[model samples]
Target: MDYFIIVITSAAGLYFHWWLYVRIKRWMDRDLALSLAGADADKRALMLQRLGEAQASGIKRGDLPAWLARAAGEYAPPRD
Candidate 1:
């Protein structure tokens, strides 16, 4: 009985963590994409080239930009 309770709670915790990760990752992607869209053409092109090289070197696509942005500074959460 104790084992069953423990397993259930553990599963719940894992699910919550996964859900939270997905939400935050999605937000980061959207934020970075919007920022890039607003950037001037030359700057945007340079950034995209860097992102492509990073992807070729084994970094996952669509992630480097957001990671770089976050490392640079924290962003405000999107309003609902």
Candidate 2:
């Protein structure tokens, strides 16, 4: 009985953790989408270019522009 209780508790904890993670991830994704939606096409392109350059040159996050810094925290790149 004790073993069964422990198993159930472990499963419940795992499920709760997974649910929380998914909810948070979805919220973040939505927030990023909204942020990027407010930007013009030119700004979006520039931001993407900046991210690419940063990745290529191994630039740190602190070196990014303010807009990008904000966007990076929420938004993901569009699908190619």
Candidate 3:
């Protein structure tokens, strides 16, 4: 039926998308990119500290408000 076809297609789409993400993530990890961004030692260390604090704050990413959620989209580049 239509629903069954949709489910299968959606699953296939998600699998392929995740596969691509994993491949590219291994190619260039986020933290490594951040470290290589030409920042000085003090700035880099401070940023890393803030990143750790953010992680420790336990604010789930999904819980971000809509405005902030859209801002997060800037982290990833558009797919080629």
Candidate 4:
């Protein structure tokens, strides 16, 4: 019975963390998208730099915080 309770609590904690991560990711995506889409060149540049850093960290473009599935027109292939 003790083991069962421990298992249940562990599972609940893991689920909570996963749920929090998803919510934060969604918020980040929304903010990043807005920043990139704005007319302010400075803000756009900043966001682009952030995107570059994320790429350097081995994160895919599709996984970037500002990634938009339906908005592919903005991204360009990286120059080597």
Candidate 5:
């Protein structure tokens, strides 16, 4: 009886862990897609234009947050 209980509990725990992992993976994929989409041409152009104006107004690169810097670095121009 005890052995059966342990086996059942272990199976349940593994299933729960797998379920959580799948859910987290799906959420991460969705967020990554959204991030990449935001780096598309229209979005990048808008951001670059804004940044240019900001720079002209004396908003230095060092003043921007690390996340913005990372995003700008990772952003790729959309391909045809």
Candidate 6:
């Protein structure tokens, strides 16, 4: 039916959109992580240490990204 075709097309569109979004997100995150990790040795060590502390303190795997983001924000320099 025509309606079935429309529904299938819409679903495919949504799936492709989501797939693209995830791909772009992953690439951007990798770029940002490399930039931050390569910026300063002391800061990088501190970030790793703090992340270890967080893991030791029982932060779950699913929550680590948000936790790391918050920790990074704390250490990030203020922008003008």
Per-model TM-score versus the true fold: 0.49, 0.47, 0.36, 0.48, 0.46, 0.48
Error of 4 at 78 (Å): 31
lDDT of all predictions, in order shown? Answer: 0.61, 0.62, 0.52, 0.63, 0.59, 0.70
| TM-score-sorted candidate list, best first | 1, 4, 6, 2, 5, 3
Clashes of 2: 0
Candidate 4 achieves a global lDDT of 0.63
Model 2, 1-80: lDDT tens per residue? Answer: 99999999999999999999989955654454346545666555655665565557765444444545665555555566
User: Which tens-of-lDDT digit does each residue in 1-80 have in candidate 1?
Assistant: 99999999999999999999999975665456447545555544544554455546766645677654553343333356
Per-residue lDDT tens digits for candidate 5, residues 4-63, read 999999999999999999899556534443454474657556455545554467654455
Taking every candidate in turn, the Cα RMSD to the unseen true structure, in Å, is 10.3, 8.0, 12.1, 9.7, 11.8, 8.4
Clashing pairs in 4: none
lDDT of 3 by residue, 6-73 (tens): 99999999999999988885344336334543355544454444444544776454442332333333
Q: Give the alpha carbon lDDT tens digit for every residue of 1-80 in model 6.
A: 99999999999999999999989965654454445566776666666776677658987657767776777767764366
What's the true lDDT of residue 69 in model 6?
A: 71
> Which residue pairs in model 6 clash with each other?
none
Q: Looking at candidate 2, what is the lDDT of residue 60?
A: 49
- Candidates 2 and 4, the one with greater TM-score: 4
- What's the lDDT for candidate 3? 0.52
Which residue pairs in model 1 clash with each other?
A: none
**Which 10-residue span in candidate 4 carries the lowest summed lDDT?**
65-74
Better of 2 and 6 by lDDT: 6
Total backbone clashes of candidate 6, pairs 3 or more residues apart or in separate chains: 0
